[model samples]
Target chain A: MPGKVVRVRRHSNFGWKERLYLPMIFVGLGVTARHFFENFWGYMIGKVKTFVVQYPEERLDYADAFRGHPVLVALESGAPKCVACGLCEFACPTDCITILPDETRSAIERIPKVFDIDMSRCMFCGLCEEACPEEAIVMSRDVELATYDREAMLFHKEDLLRTEEQLGRRIGFIREEYNRA
Target chain B: MSDLLQAIEEKLGDAVEDSHAYRGDDTILVSHDRVLEVMQTLKDDSSFRFNMLIDLTAVDYLGRDPRFEVVYHLGSVEVEARGSEPSSLRHRLRVKSGVAEVPCEIDSVTSIWPAANWMEREVFDFYGIRFKGHDDMRRILLYEEFQGHPLRKDYPKERRQPLIGPRN
Candidate 1:
């Protein structure tokens, strides 16, 4: 269907109501005034609830399924839980993840000597999290990752690492998802 | 053998190399040389008017002798409004033809259904399977300077190309 051309009708002539503009303008203003009055009255009575959070001052808790960005799960010892299997790297469609596996003296046998994720290239599709065999990589609620510097966006292994406690919600959600599947 | 497949086989005869109704999907394997003729017949045939070209793609079997197989999914819509007993029926058929590795080209169905234009281009882009008689054949997904067909089994997955255009 990609080759099919859909012709949408464009209205060049404005109707009398649109051309007059004053009546429609009043209608729009009436809508605004209605909302303002309703909100003001509700606020005065302290019965109205708001959808907006005070952003920086008050952070809204994201749901467990809300995928923000990929992060490496770290153990209590500060070492990454990842064994450098490279499944996540391979699963990444955008090739944003880069990993260099090295022999580790730990029982895991291997660890990523260098792991970098170019945030600019990362689409936050959570394919890396799904492909992780050890559940070492997961999507965290770290949505506010805007940076002024391009270099800052290229997150190193250290920058991507989050402790188990910090990622408890996501881990639980993943476990539940896998269990259901 | 489905009735549809039987009809197709009877209509096309020697052009149809093999056919099967594997699972529920009715598929007919046609000779690459006679693909355009087969497609035209399928589209124009009154009993099996496959008016819509649903999907067009190619598969690469690395070790296979032919190496590439272009697949086409054709769909037909039927409206049976006979004296208040109104009903609509739909039928689907899969057509596949093997293309040799040396001359990896197959006849384009674009002349019959214009929807095959970009799909043929995409097949050409990723699998390096050119569609014969396709106008303005160029890379659909990748850049023009892209070295190899990425979907080909022989193409290295991790192979990175030099940055083109400008580097910020």
Candidate 2:
């Protein structure tokens, strides 16, 4: 079957008002008015606004469950809470944790000679902290861990181990609990 | 096991350096350059129709000559009977390549397996291994201004402490 071709007639000229450019001007004005009204209404209702937290002055409060950097706890007698059992290191899937053993006077067998937590490789799974039987290693709330050098991100025993005096002034309820603990 | 390895050997020939079938699972080690060709053959060939890429990652053998080995786990989903367990047979292929400051970009498999997008991005993000034709090749987790690749072996963990305060 062959397809049929149809011919169409073309209009010669625009109407009086269309030729005068009034309709075109009205369409342009309508578009401009619509945008202006929308923006004006948004501004009046404070919808089209930018609100940002002053990060330096207004710090965010993290929830109690927020697992941040892992911390090594210190005993009441100023000794590290780690028994140097190497359980945390073994439990770490990424092998980011490294611990060295040292003899301590207390009955608590071995102390970590050198505890290193590679924050770079650490997946922040909280597995190491959970594997700690001595309640020594814990994920702290101090999450501001921006660093320039790769070397600086690998935290050693001294860097991760937190002391009561070092925690400074308490700001939230968790700080009070940490102090009490 | 020998039959499958022999089939791969026949198809890929010299490209695959070594082939090992462990407990009905095949693992073929090949050179970095030949990975794309091998993958394409596996996908197109009738015997081994590995249409899906399960995982793609890189392992940094820091001391080895070709320091990086990109591992690809390929599989095809096979439907089972209603009462039976659905199974998938996966083949792991490791391609050895040089890892230096000059980035090593592998031919991306996202065209074959769309799921490789995030996995490749993750590998690139953590290991700094580049995928040549990735649509958006940017850091997934880390901030844009982040400095060094943290997963590299030499990255230190101590110097991040503030000078005046006690280290946390």
Candidate 3:
């Protein structure tokens, strides 16, 4: 029986009860009735909660782990925390991030002249955020970004920079997570 | 695994330039001339039925005498199901040959495996190592109009390849 071929049954020959389908229907209905009664009783008693929240009018808080568009962190001095190390630029798989740095800038020897990130090309893999050693960039919680024009999606340095006051929760989460790792 | 390697080494004496285990995985370095013969033997011969060609890729050693290293990963689909102790699954072979920058050449093992067709094409697309007997040796990964082989060690990073589609 080295190369023995054993054929197994694929289908079960249905009985009369299965063929009539009344019991099956009633069983399905029973499940529905159970849920309906539970919810109905819960609603009447105000014990169990309903998950269906009134959205748009009543917004639920987003978790700190929620990934969204990447933003550059800036201190109170209004200067970008990124030293133009080009780690994020290299780490970006889509090549959406472009950092133009001026070597002549003395006070901050490595300051980004133009940091453009094309959101259209970004797959949001979080490589750019992860590669930032300075903790300059991290994914924000604002996931509701939409625009009709293609040009609007291209985030420049001016649009990317967010102060501590602006990025309260995301920066805190990133700091905690980084410290843990 | 060593017994298997010893058998192969004994069978292919001079053809096998070197053979050793790397990171618990067996590796055989064969001369470029006998690569096809060695591959055929491995597949048809019961002792080493490496029927599956898992991967075929090329490495660029730019400054070395042999500019390219063609690596072959071979195993069998049925080996696992057979409980045959798949030391061959992790085992691989590296064939080295001096491929000149302009007209790099290597005989395609597509006839032996047929899975090597696309893999070889991808290697050709990236490393520009021309396969001798391949039916369709066109670029598999990059566009046909792509200027130079991108995976080459000397390929200029700054050189902008001509964009394919809409600029806007």
* Every model's DockQ: 0.06, 0.04, 0.10
| Preferred candidate (TM-score higher): 1 or 2 | 1
**Top-DockQ structure, candidate number:** 3
What would the per-residue lDDT of candidate 3 be over residues B1-168, giving only the tens digit for each residue?
A: 577688888887888887777665667887666788888888888777778888888889998867888888787555444343323353444434445555688888999999999999999999989888999989988888898899898998787987788545
Where does candidate 1 clash, by residue pair?
A: none
Chain A TM-score values for every predicted structure, listed in order: 0.80, 0.61, 0.78
Greater-lDDT candidate between 1 and 3:
1
Candidate 2 stretches greater than 4 Å from native: A1-181, B21-25, B79-103, B157-168
TM-score of 1: 0.73
Question: lDDT per residue, candidate 1, B1-168, as tens digits?
Answer: 888888888988999999888899999998899999999999898989998999999999989978889999999965544444433446899999999998888888889999999999999999999888999799989988899999999998889997898645
Pull out the clashing pairs in model 3. none
Q: What is the Å distance of residue A160 in model 3 from its true position?
A: 2.8
- Candidate 2, residue A28: the lDDT equals 94
Candidate 1 lDDT, tens digit per residue, A6-67?
45688778899889999889999999898888888888999765556787998877776999
Alpha-carbon lDDT, every model: 0.89, 0.74, 0.81
- For candidate 1, the share of real interface contacts preserved is 0.00
> Which prediction has the highest TM-score against the true structure?
1
Ranking by lDDT: 1, 3, 2
